[model samples]
Target: MENIAGTKSSLSWAVHISVAALVLIWLFPTVGLFVSSFRTADQIATSGWWKAAFPSEQNLTLRTDPPSTQVQKGGQWVIEGNLFGDKRGATISVYGTSSREISTYKAGETGKFRNGATITVQPNGDYVASSDTKWKGGRGPRVFVTAVTPPEFTLRNYQMVLFDPANREGMARAFFNTLTVTIPATVIPILVAAFAAYALAWMDFPGRALLVAAVVGLLVVPLQLALIPLLSLHNDIGIGKGYLGVWLAHTGFGLPLAIYLLRNYMVGLPRDIIENARVDGATEFQIFTKIILPLSFPALASFAIFQFLWTWNDLLVALVFLIDSTGETTVMTKQIVELLGTRGGNWEILATSAFVSIAVPLMVFFAMQKYLVRGLLAGSVK
Candidate 1:
């Protein structure tokens, strides 16, 4: 009864719940990164991305007008100005004249300074400081305010991360460099593997079984073990440490899985189609080009997504093979690593850079994701 045809499973709701949880787990960080990328440094530092839509309270250290701006008025030296300067609409809840007691006085309350000077701050960040004698300091008094500010979002983080001319650590160059590495790395392997996979799946060869076994075995080989040897071989062949070397490395590493996936998919295609084409005077090449390639698109796209993501996010291979003293060949992963060292505290910049790096991969995945499960399940059924 439980296995009756077309009947619903008892645990279908559980499966749905599990899938929803997984989606949320993956979605939260990506959404957070997207939201954080548009936020200002102060906003990101003080609050989480989940709070981006609402007003936030922050303790800010601001300065009043300097003594130079003070004027003699009503037998006292007075300094009057807005703490936020041109920025408006923030309401200060509590104010303080010293760091130790940052929230000593509520907004609109007057407090006396050390030298008998009285300062009053309004909720709107306007302040008036008056001293009976003369103000002596070159600098203004430091006032700390706990203010509730409206949500702020900005494009300046993207400006600095991508388009700023003076930003030495900008991602524009690294972005193009990653694309240079990833596009060729992905395309070359698919091109080479498609041919090999077609031969293995459709064409009878003397060592076909051995070749398939070899590709399967190569899948288990650790990439780290081959890096130094492959690098040495590349150097010996005079293709050392550049785009060519990295491209070849990625292609070599990617081909086994590509061939395995594509071969499985190509093998499962209706044999009648290939037999009829062959019996009708079509060559193996003709059958492959016309019939097989079109049907194998899902598999090709699946491998493309995997290979594109791997090569795009690759850092160790780039570091080993794309050596450049001037950072001309640096990829986004390497650039982000450099940012961790140089601008570690700038969370907004880091968030913007991280989101920018993943943007293309996300687009690629979503664009071809329908094929992913279809391709992966190709030979498993038949």
Candidate 2:
């Protein structure tokens, strides 16, 4: 009884720990980015996102009156100014005479360092600093002050990414290009492979094992190995460097896996149902259209997810094939890479682009995830 109780407690502890860690791991960066996306460029550069969550202190520089600019009024050189110009409600905590370190006192207090050098900075961007000791000076002491900043966030980055014309050459065009490649590349393989899978799965033929083995073998052969040769083949066939060439390449590359997966799922289907359709005077095409197709929805949807995602995110093949005589045929992945080269410091652009690129995949996953898992498990159980 004690052992069982201990095990239950241990399991509960493990679950709690796992959930806490996962929540932190997922939320930490997302929260940081959420905070950072709203902050000013300077704020982002100077402090971490966590630091931005609380009020932050900033070191500021204020000009002091030179002896030349100072008027000898009441037997003392005096100057008046306020550091925060018309900006209200800034808390000034301390003042320093040098730029190296700004804080020398807290709010409503004076620094011993500034002793005999009374410097006053008001919230309304005016200041008056004077020295009690007689002034004979070339340069007055440089004044430093610390000010508090409040929380801030903005949707400017999204606006700049979506609506800005300058972004067109980048994500906007690449988005369209990705869709162009992804749609055709996805459609061609599914259409061709569906027929091929139906043939391989249901139709009787000689050398069927050998053909299936060849298709399966192609799966293990890395597509990278055939890059140059396939490019050469395209060139030889006069399909060089265009959307059609790219579409064909993706279809060819995506075909073997598609055919294999679909065949496995299709073949597992009850042979009796297929034979009954045949016995009822249906041709192979009619059987596939009526019976096989309905049963194969899960497999087809799963393959569609795979193809759409692969084609959408592909960089290398797109580089080799769709990369152009015209520079217009660039995809999202390629554009993101190029932006990293040119706009390295633009975090807003980088984050927004990344989010935009993944947005479709997220939608696709949510939409077809059920079928993907179901199709994958189809043949395994039976």
Highest lDDT: give the candidate number. Answer: 1
Whole-model alpha-carbon lDDT for candidate 2: 0.76
Model 1: per-residue Cα lDDT over 3-121, one tens digit each: 88766768889989999999999899889989999999999999988999999999999999889999999899999999999989889999989888889999999977766799999
Candidate 2 TM-score versus the reference: 0.76
lDDT of each: 0.90, 0.76
Location of the lowest summed lDDT over 10 successive residues in candidate 1: 373-382
Leading candidate by TM-score: 1
Candidate 1: stretches off by over 4 Å = 1-22, 66-69, 114-116, 132-139, 378-382
TM-score, cand. 1 vs. native: 0.88
Model 2 RMSD vs true structure: 6.3
Give the Å error, residue 343, model 1.
3.5
Question: Each candidate's TM vs. the true structure?
Answer: 0.88, 0.76
C-alpha displacement of 268 in model 1, angstroms? 2.1
lDDT of 2 at 214: 94
